[model samples]
Target: MSTAYGLTAVSLVVAATVLIGMFGLRISRTTSDFYVASRTVSPLRNASAIGGEYLSAASFLGIAGLILAYGADMLWLPVGWTGGYLVLLVLVSAPLRRSGAYTLPDFAEARLESMTVRRVTSVLAVLIGWLYLMPQLQSAGLVLRTAAGTPVWVGTVLVAVVVTINVLSGGMRSITMVQAFQYWLKLTALAVPVLFLLIAWRQDAAPGLGGDAPPTFPERTTVSIGTDVTVRVPAPVTVEVRGRVDGAGRAGPLTLTAGEHTVARDTVVTFPAGAAVPHVADLPVRTDAEWLRPLAGREYPMYATYSLILATFLGTMGLPHVLVRFYTNPDGRAARRTTVLVLGLLGAFYLLPALYGALGRIYAPELLMTGRTDAVVLTLPGRLIGGTLGDLLGALVTAGAVAAFLSTSSGLAVSVAGVIAQDLMHGGVRSFRVATLLALLVPLGLALSVRALAVADVVGLAFALAASTFCPLLVLGIWWRRLTVAGALAGLIVGGGLAGTAVAWTIIGGPPGGLAGALLAQPAAWTVPAAFAVMIGVSLITPRSVPAGVARTMVRLHTPETLAVDRGTWHPKGA
Candidate 1:
């Protein structure tokens, strides 16, 4: 039965994508159409495409899972993710579009008037693009394996082939139509199940615990501290226990010693359930938790906050898939309008995932044991609804999950392919064809060899890379007239090197904790400012190195839309 449902959904999605691609193919005539839809996309349609492509596997699956594991604190992930668009809309959208570039590298070259900067930007774009694509492929493999008991790689290969064909055949134009359709398809896929599950939950009287008895604690619970010490509690307790120490760095079991005892490492204390529990809210503002609230935990420190901010803000602007959609607009004003529409569409879609997370906290707490809370959103349908309705809902979620993977992977592949063709092969039919194959193959190979990282973690790494590299280049090159080639290179080396190292550590060593962990997890706060500083300082020291056409470029970037032409001369207008 599961196989049947899976096959049916897959067939329908493929058929729809092919049909859409064929529609695009009939109208797509020139290289310009394939690359940027001849820069004619309307604001509304472009916005839908942006929303579709932007909500990758991480947004669809990872956010709910993180919320399930971390409670309300995880809400920041989605909030940060969506807030990124707001920052992009305000700071970079119009000016970036007005630059009249096909990709990030194009803008880097045009603005900086340096082939060196263009090459550097292109390399970073491919890196970020591939890094982002890893999670999407992994998610595809996971969905097929979980839903249909198929070999994991089946889904990955299927998607790679389909996306490659779509991109190779029609490029950005084909994907825009496909992604716009997918956005609605995904929303329906999720919304339908949610509505049905809500109905089922209500019809079943919305019982607390879903007819299961409350969990009972064991007669005795053991509390372990540091490396070795353990204490046995006679009953369940909510108490703060302090420890004491002796010399030689060896501590005995936790006990109240004579006069004054200090809390020691490896000490364990236990209390009964009736004991006083620490009330975090009532604590003084100077309490450790209060002091550390800005950081997610002691293990992460300031890195967590900075990482979130960087991922949310800089990451949005750096994303190649997201940026390419702007190229589809008729002009800078249309791009700005498209971004505004995306903000509304994304804001609406985000609300549902939060709802799912809240529902999972109640209906599927057991997900913690599996350590795969990412599946909570998928499993909730069956648990909340029952029998056939539950199965149907589950299938719908499976479809959405598949769509998330396909749409995101497709977009990233398109960006990577475009960059490769333009920078490496000099942008033509042959370059596009070869680049398409390389784009799909490289990421697919990486996805196959590596164990699947958490979706958000992988996506965050992509963001960190973008923040370290492109974010600085874009922001500074657009706003700062003093930006020099030397400075951009220096910043790219320092910021990009640091961010890239952190990503490597994350992938190989797993999530770093403590200060190093904080740095690895969220290098953005430091890296972003550092990149900007380096760019400015270096440019200041070498004023003569500034691009010769700086004034003209600046004029184009800030001029109003009324002065801009549809074909060649582009200019930004007042917000």
Candidate 2:
């Protein structure tokens, strides 16, 4: 693939995003436009905007990589992610819009009638936003480094700058347009390439895509490892190498019967045509048969699968970015309608990543050895179909990848910055500019400092945290009339503390294998239930502490806007 094409594609995406932001700036003259698009967006546009911002690096790049590496078990990821919105639509969407809060903290304060709860919600919103933002930045680095052959930091900084500028221009109103445009751009980008790829696959007529054997190199191939990787090879073979291997510098052919071999950073290893690709130390190696069967290929597969399902299904409602988008709708019915359309849009977009993953397993198996599976989506175009057409397809994918990062990062920056400006600084455009800087910087630092994990896996942690903290609060505050301020605060503390600790442990200190590791890595299954239980128990105990306006608030949340009764649709100050 030509680096020029990738760079051009990325450049165009950035330019388009900024231009869209400027267009939004033309209409964004007031605070309401900055925060919630003046709550005038129709269902279809809001849904498209939501879909744009919602499909992050995890959907664009990570799902295919995980599916390529893990096969059937990883399919649950997309299923859960899509189904989570179903959970959201049925439970939170309309009532949340009815609540008339511009932000999650606003919702918290309205429901609990406590500034303390509002502050807690504000902090949790920031935490979730930053946690989600880190992986978006990291994935941007990966995409740019692959597409344009640039330094990883260059991509991260580029996304940060573009997102900050866009957010500062018009805030949510601007981003809504940018995001809605990107959603279609991304869908077309992925969908068109796959058509070409499928044609190429048919012309080649390659077999063994789902064979019983492990993946093998079809021809002599040289794989350059950008990062150090420990690979477990099944058999010994002589291989030509350049750079460090197992801490020893080697520049010539070497023979090794491998159990595990360390290929140092920047090493180029050449494998013979028929050599079986080795598995990365972090991922499980499996036969084709096992890979085709769910729960058969992974350690503690059942537990991990269920945990993943729980995390994504319950987690969607808690995301600060997602919740912020709901406020863009004009009314409760529009919110519900937006969610239904989102389900369709998201469902359609998700189908393509699985296709990419399946094709990747057949054509790009060497990624397993290099632990660069995430690059499979970018590399497949060139590998499957070479020449100018291949380069064009690759560039399209690159553009989509860039759009993914820009749309998601922009939304997160806006959400986090909104919370910070509203809660900490003055509620105005100037404070928002300051907040955007603060929001982007901390996550960029974290993205650089942390070891790169699978993008989807890291995102799952954010979901888990969201599921633990806000899922309970939203569910209880809206549905349970007896919920008290004490209950919401206690639940947020306990759930956020546990989930946050688990996140730290997984990131800073890798967890050990077995049930404990599975539990820690995917904490939502236990943590979400624990949060709900704590909130409910505490609410029951302190029933007398329920807000005096509970009846009116319930009526406001449940009543139709058409009814002349107040539905809490007042304009929010710092929302």
Candidate 3:
């Protein structure tokens, strides 16, 4: 990989992003323009922007890594991610746009008619936004470190600063253009490289994927461990080491037994051609046959798969960054149309990552050992076809990776900042600017402090929290008509508290394996239903707590925009 090329690509992306923000700055004279692009974004453009912001590091990098390491079962990640939008389209998109709320808190206040509910929703929105943003920041560091050999913090700080600048410059107005461009840019970057990679594969006789044997190095390979790692080797093999391994400092070939061995930080191990790749201890071990089959590939596979589906399927609607984009649409109909188009765009883009992952298994199997499976997309071109062309392709991928981080982080920052400004500050431009700083800073600090979880797993945690809390509130508030303020607040507290505890534990020190660990790791399956039940039960118990405006709110949420009915409209503070 060429650092010069990687750095150049990253620089161009940052400059272009800032330039787009400047363009938005010219048109953003009003608060509405800054907040929701004056609610005038067209369906196609808005859909493109949604695809851009929704496809984060998890989609671009993490999904490929998971596929390469975990095998067939990991396909559910892309499926669930894209299908979550379907759930959103059918359930919440149009009605949410019709609510005429500037932010989630505004929606809560309007629908529930309770300031307390608004405050609680504001806190959850900020929390979910931050949880979502943290992974984009961490994955930015991973991409930069792999592409340019930069320090981890360099990428984290760089993305944080760039996103803050973009958000503060024009907020949603500027980000819409930048993100829309980014979607195409990312699609081209991945799509073009994969075509070349496929050509390369065909030139080499198109190796078959079904094999009973585990992935093995095609040639003698040297793997450098960026961080200390414990790996599970299936069989004993002699390997040359340059650094600490198994509590011994060795520079000569040594035999490793068939078990777990710890490789110290910065260690380099050379394996003979055809040596089996060892997986990181953090990942569950599976035979090649098991890896090829769904449900058999992972521990407690059925439960884990179902939990992932539950989280992503119900979670998309609650994501603060995603929901804010719907508010940019001119009307409820445009919002629905935008969601329909987003489904197509996202579906098309997702096909490429899975291809990269499967190819990675054949071409760059050593990544499994290094536990840097997340680098599969970035490293594949360089490994499979080395030369200036490989470097160029790798740089294009690097630029796309940077775009993923920048666009998603910028959107999340804007959503978080908007909530903070509207609810916590004076709801002015200056307050938004300050809020932008806070929004980026908290997650940046967290990204630096916490050990890196798999990028997709971190995102899954955010989805679980969102699913458990906001999914219930949004669904019941819009449809049930009997949802009470007390119910919404209680649901938010109970669901958020439960899911947040699981997320914190997963981050700090994940729980030990068992039924408890399985449940904690993927909390949505249990937590989401619990949230709905609690909300419904509390609402039934406290019937008087229902908002007096429930009927009006329902009419406003459900009425077609084509009809000339007067659905109540609430303007922002200054509007």
Candidate 4:
């Protein structure tokens, strides 16, 4: 694809988002508008906005790439992600909306009647938002580097600057429309190019996926290693080399053994047609048959699969960015309706990425060798379809990729800013603007400083962190009237402590092989249950610490907003 097209596509998305936000700024003139769009969004628009922000890089780019490399087992990711909304609709949406809380901290304090619980909740909410934001920035960097030849930091900084401007302009009110618009743009951008791609595949005699064999390069391909990486080669193959390999410089054909080999940064290795692809050290290598089988290629597959499923299924209600969007609905009923519509919207958008992943195996297997499978979606448009037409489609895909990053980052920024401004600054538009800047800055630095992890892997860990903390608090606090202040606090500390520990350990030092690796990589199955058990056990032992207003809080949470009652809407303490 032309560099001009990539730059133009990115510029258009930025311009469109800003223009839409400016339109929202015209009508947003009060504190309520800044916080929750004055609680008047229709269900369709609300659901669209939710889909816009929710379908981060994980949904748009990562899923397809994971499927390309890991195959059938990876399908569970989308299943768990979409099914999470079902969990939210059934257990959380109506009650959370009826609570009339502007943020998680507000809900925690009102339900438990303790500023202590509120403060803990505020800290956890901010942490979750930042965890989620880092991946958006990282994915943006990866996309821009692919689309244009710019350094990764350029895309990372660009997204942060744009998100900060939009949130500071009109807060949630402005971003709602901005998110809603991006969702359709993303959908169109992805959905349209796929049709032509499928047509091209059919015209090429429908190449087989190398039945029961490891992925192979379809044609001669040259792969440039971006960083030092060890790849596991399944078989020996003669390849032309032009850079450092195994601490020696080479410029001619060499046969690599069928085992681990190290390729240094900036090395260029050329593979001939029919060469077995060598994958990164960490990724699972599978034959087509094994790839089609469940739990066949990965380590401790059963434990890893179940743990991931548990995190995504139970974690949706815990995500601060996702939960805060409910407050934009007009009433509890609207919240429920919006969630129902979100289920459908998310279901529709998720089906497109799998196609990209599946076709990638046949058309773009070189990505597997380079360990940049995430670029499969962008590469497919140019590889299968060529010339000016292909570049145009590629540009459209680039635009959609940018939308994925910006839409999701904007939501996270708004949620984090809302918490900071409400809980710490005592609530005001100016405070919110300052908070927005802070929210974007922390994640921007993290994105720039930390080495990039797989986009989906980082997001899954964020869900685990959320599952361990807010999942227990929200579920127990809303339904179980006996939840006490002390219990909530203990659970927050224990749950957040364990899940956070697992995430940090997994990121910093690679886990040991066997069960220990799987456990650290996906801890929700154990950590989530441990969190709930601690919250319940502690609450039972400390029954005396239950809030005196528990009964009234229950009524407010469970009651329909249509009912005639004082429905004490929650705000930050002393606000």
> Global lDDT of each model?
0.72, 0.89, 0.90, 0.88
lDDT of 3 at 488: 88
RMSD in Å for all candidates: 9.3, 1.3, 1.2, 1.5
Q: Could you tally the backbone clashes for each prediction?
A: 3, 0, 0, 0
Candidate with better lDDT, 1 vs 4: 4
- Per-residue lDDT of model 1, residues 530-570, tens digit only: 77788778888988888888888888777776874333443
Question: How far in Å is the alpha carbon of 450 misplaced in model 2?
Answer: 0.9
Residue 145, model 4, lDDT: 88
Off by over 4 Å in 2: 567-571
Can you rank all candidates by lDDT, best first?
3, 2, 4, 1
Candidate 3 local Cα displacement, residue 394, angstroms? 0.3
Model 2 scores worst on lDDT over the 10 consecutive residues at 566-575
Q: Name the better of 1 and 3 by TM-score.
A: 3
lDDT for position 289 in model 2:
73
Worst 10 residues of 1 by lDDT: 277-286
lDDT of 4 by residue, 174-252 (tens): 8899889889998998999999999999998887665988888889988888778889888898999999888899999
- Evaluation by TM-score, superior candidate among 3 and 4: 3
Better candidate number, 1 or 2, judged by TM-score? 2
